[model samples]
Target: MTAPTTSRAARAALVLALLVTGLSMRTAVTSVGAVLDDLQDDLHASGGAAGLITTMPVLCFAAFGAATPRLARALGPHRLLVVALAVTTVGLATRPFAGGVALFVVVSTAALAGSAVSNVLMPSLVKLHFPDRIGTMTALYTTALAVGVTAAAGLTVPIGEAGDGWRQGLAAWAVVSAVAVVPWLPTVAADRRARATTLAGPVAPTGPDAAGSAAPPARAVPMSALLRSRTAWALTVFFGTQSMQAYITFGWFARFLTDHGIESGTAGAMLAVLTALSIPVSLVVPRIPARHHRAVVGLFVVCLATAYVLMAAAPRPTAWIWVVLAGVGGGSFPLLLTLLGMRARTADTIATLSAFVQAIGYLIAGTGPLLFGALYGVTGSWALPIAVLFTALGVMTVASRRSTTPRFVDDELAASPR
Candidate 1:
């Protein structure tokens, strides 16, 4: 079915809401990491215990995101996202008061679940609301997400100074999430109307005959078909590998720099630069036409390889060079997100494929740091893990090429003889 055209103002409003929603999603997790050292000192937690705090977002993302589509199907995306924002707000605000690690983890898990739902749903939201402007909207929200993370990391410590310490600093993001929910009130109203219409009668269920008359758009491709597609598996693996690299870099890059004799403050600044660099690249890459994906991804991979080589050979003096190259390599994060929409024809497919990719992908990703960290512990050198990252990037480049090929997920599934 043809999508109803939204007025420019309404479209702009939706984009604003999406930007706020995207901002709300990542800050809760990153802010926690910004203050992790303080939390560890306060709780007297072991390195493993402290690491879990940073890592919990990935676990919650995979677990909760695996189930988000089911929830979105039942509640509808806008209403569900509103509920997610509410949960995120409550979780962030309340976790600071938890006096111990166990309670903190529980509350943080709850918060991250909310963020996970938002993360998985954003692409589908973009698909549904801004089909014609997928690249633009994706870039806008991605840019906001990048800025949100940078701001939280840069400012949280100063914010925390007004209160007891890191706990209060961490809790400050509750304001961001809380404020984000405001723009969604209009969206929730619209979702209620749509849900009402959907429930009012037989809902004009779609069929093979949908194109001729009053059948709903051909029943959304079953998730089962998506599961059978070679394209789907390739994209999912691509997403997983990129996420593994992303999570590892976010969680451990600073420590690696410090270990190499950089001061902690300078290391943190370098890591921030790596993250900040992704913002412009994220905005620009998605806006490029599909034909160029291979060249773009190829260049970024080459840059990443160069960075890895530098780190292995002359990590200290050339650290800036490595940081810049590594940031571009990580551009795959947004590029993959853009493909989720660019790839799927129907909003249902976008939503389901997103849930499937991220759910499975993050579970795979969540293991990267632990596995590599364990390898480091056993071998006592950075070479082994760096080599492992090289292997992941090699495989990721292959999968990314397959995912970027100009084919729609729905088209692939429909062409199946089965």
Candidate 2:
């Protein structure tokens, strides 16, 4: 290939790397969820075992997500992602064949661990490769991520029914995970070239020209320094609250709808609508300029709070409206991904912040469904849980508004006391 065509081919490969990796990130979680009942029956698992399976995504995301930055430093982000995809493929392909629930959970955890690391790496990879088009690239990848979540949720059951069992259904996603690895192999080669470039010269690669042309610069700020940065804290809180809201909706919203007198089938459809709406919202939110992010955050807060209020006050009559509003509010996730790029200058900073934000943020998120379930169990009414979630929206709004302000975590880290 000519130099120009070779560069174009490399760029195309990187884009595919982002899109497919995002598409695979949630497949391990949602495919199992789609066939949870069948899988539980086949494995003869108890309710608690099943619950642990359902909860593993956030738990794995928190623990492994925190470890990803260090892993990336050692592996190089591109090579680490190739390893992650390999792990994902193996875990997905194997978990379905386990004879017992214990083995199933173990392999499933492996799959989620891979997905978790991939999740943390995305923002940094985008920052490294497509720095000039963060908005567009983020929109593309997150939209793909949303599609993966929706497709796995919507299709796994039918595939299960058509095949040998839930095992076949869950294992089928391994194909997609394996395909996601292809683009990254070439990208790892690019990383090698980048490292060679760094070794051959005194001047370092920086900015958009550095895309796949140099290794990410060494970290200027230690991860511990983030503890003292207000911007980092604000982003963490914002990410946590939004993630909590999303997990609660996915985990409990169907029951919440059914409890409010909607038919079970309709409630399931509404939940699908809520999940599917994230695709378009993900596409749109990133295109909004940073100048208007505060307003965008306010709009999401209003949509979410309104959805909660309507669900609490007039759920059955306005169920569709609530779904639509909540769907719009789900844009918070894509918006946060965009902010992950905006809040850091260098690829290294983005990687650090992404890890810090998603690690503790996911731990915070993991509590929402449990807390919501507990509150409802205690009160025997959705009122208490809805009210609590409404309060969380308030917190998310404050944090998101603060984090959306034009500030870099790197600058804040520099100013923080050692």
Candidate 3:
């Protein structure tokens, strides 16, 4: 069947919705990392609990990602996006009012669940709506995500200094999601109408196939199908390891610096630079020739390795350099996200792969912060924790070698049962 056609205006509006959604969702999650100390102090949270605060969104992302494909199938992707956005809005708006850690967890979990679905759906949306501009649009959306992260991480302290409660600082991001919905209203209506028509079709009794034998029942693509594909497993490992590194940095890098004798504000600024630098790096790296992409991947790994070495060896004057290296390596994130679209054979395959990869991938990824923190608690120094990061990067290097190859689509197709 030919894909459904949407007008240019509608497409533009949908893209806008995606960009704004990306920005809002990222801001909500990253802002707390920027002000972790303040939030911990204000709420009287322990280090372990503060760690959970950061990990909560990632856990929700993994949990909710599994449900997105089924939800999209039932509600239609467009309408599901509307509901997700609304949930995100409510989640963000309520953060300031939560009475304690339990309430904070509830609100934050809901918001991140919404954001998680949105993240998984975004690639398919790009494929459906802007097939011709996947690379460009991926770059844009990823850039918006980077900018949002940087803004939230960088500005939270300043905003709090300006007498806005950190709660208010964090809650303010909901307005972005609310604004993003404006451009989506018409598309949501159209999707609801289309779904209504689909449901109203003449009913045929469910029975055997045309051959007169019982029709082979449609089963979910087996989870093992993904496990058996070397490429899929490689991508999963790549995503999981890199994501672990990213979240480790997001959740603990500021505190790590502060512990190393940097002031909290300086640490936050360094984190902002690390995130902001990813915008240009993400945009530029994808445009390079595919044959040479592995070299870029190697460069990122080297940068990460060097940054970890410096962070462990020289903690003060060289901290900024380490942050820059981390930022450059962070570009791999958007690269992986873009590849999810580029590497899939069909929209159905992309949806399936997206759900599987993000769900399993993030569950693995979500452990980094807790593990690193626990290691610190035991070792009583950052050195061993930094060593663990280096090990993860080494694993990422091996996984990325396969991932950077321009053949996952072909590999997945060849591996699929005929």
Candidate 4:
């Protein structure tokens, strides 16, 4: 039997749900970075501990990404998202009330995990629900995510100054998550009804040429197969290295600027600009076809390289030019995510690739901030660390070129016929 088709109304509802979900998940991670200094002073925390607050959310992305497929398999994607949102609410609510370092860590980690699962599952949702509009919707959702991160990062300082304390400032983002749930609830309900009516009996087994096949055998495309693919490795490495660079800027660029004699507020505003400027690029780039992927990737690398050189060598006025260049270069993120969706042969394949790529990739990426910090601590200068970033970007250039080709999923499917 054919599966039930979604109505236009259902499709619209899914789009809205995804937008809000993306916004809320980003706010959870970005808000704390904006108010880090206030939180540190208020809680009497050390620099390393404050850094952990920022790092925790990213680490959670890798840690919890591995579980998203299992959760989706058991609960269905819509229901799993609701659970993730609920967990996010609990995590945000408890953060303000945490009495000590231990409690803060626990609550923060919980929040991060929720955000992580949402991040991993969202691309698949986009692929499943809006395959025709993948380019457009991917652009929109990614732009929303960039906007959310920028707003939270820019507003956290002002919000903390407005009232209660840093705790309240950090906790305020729960409201966004709560509002996101309104549209999602109906989607979840509809999904449950759909599942109950459709899957009333055991699934049929497929020998060959079975259109009803639920999924392929695990052995068909083992982890070893993915590991052996150069394209897959290049994609993974490209994603990992760019992510590391992004986090390094996100987590420490403000501090780096402040240490170099810029005022704290100015540094923070610049950081906000860096994140905010990417929104337009992210919204526009994914709508274009794969033919221009290599050119775009090469342009991003050049922008990043130019940004690093100016940042290290130039004086004040020209420095911000490089900053803007760096922001525009970071547009590669949405491009990569869109490529991931377009590269997968099936939903199950997307899930497996996402888990493997993100889990190992993010863990490798997670070391950037710590390594940058350690390098600075030892050398007592930004020059060497900036060089390190340039080197990473160089590697990113080559890896991105390999990933820009559009033939991986096709090759895999052709190799392993049904």
- Candidate 1 lDDT tens digits, 1-418: 2233568877677878988887777988788777887888787778878878877887888889877777776786778888999999999999987878888889998899999998888988887777667777888888888888888888888889977788888888999888888877776666655653221111221222122223234444545677878878888899888888887788778888998999999998899899999888878987877778889899889998999899899999999999989988888888888888777665666777888898888888888888878888999889998987898899899998889886666666766877
Candidate 3: tens digits of C-alpha lDDT, residues 1-418: 1135778877777778778876876877877776677778877788778868877777788889888877776676777778888888899889766777778888888788888888887876666565556666777788778777777777776776776678777777788888877776776665666653121111111211112222122223444466656667777889999999998987789889999889998886788788789879867765554566678788888899989989888978799999999999987888777777666544445555677788888988887877898899998989788887988898989998887666543345345785
Model 1: colliding residue pairs: none
Better of 1 and 2 by lDDT: 2
Root-mean-square deviation of every model: 4.1, 4.1, 6.5, 4.9
Question: What's model 4's lDDT at 167?
Answer: 78
TM-score: which candidate is best?
A: 2
lDDT for model 1 = 0.80
Ranking by TM-score: 2, 1, 4, 3
C-alpha lDDT (0 to 100) for residue 351 of candidate 4? 54
Residues 123-174 of candidate 2 have per-residue lDDT tens digits of 8787777766888899989999999999999998888889887888899999
Worst 10 residues of 3 by lDDT: 201-210
- The lDDT per prediction is 0.80, 0.83, 0.74, 0.74
RMSD of 4: 4.9
Off by over 4 Å in 3: 1-3, 41-48, 157-164, 193-224, 408-418
Residue 127 lDDT, candidate 3, scale 0-100: 60
Question: Which runs in model 1 stand beyond 4 Å of their true positions?
Answer: 1-5, 196-216
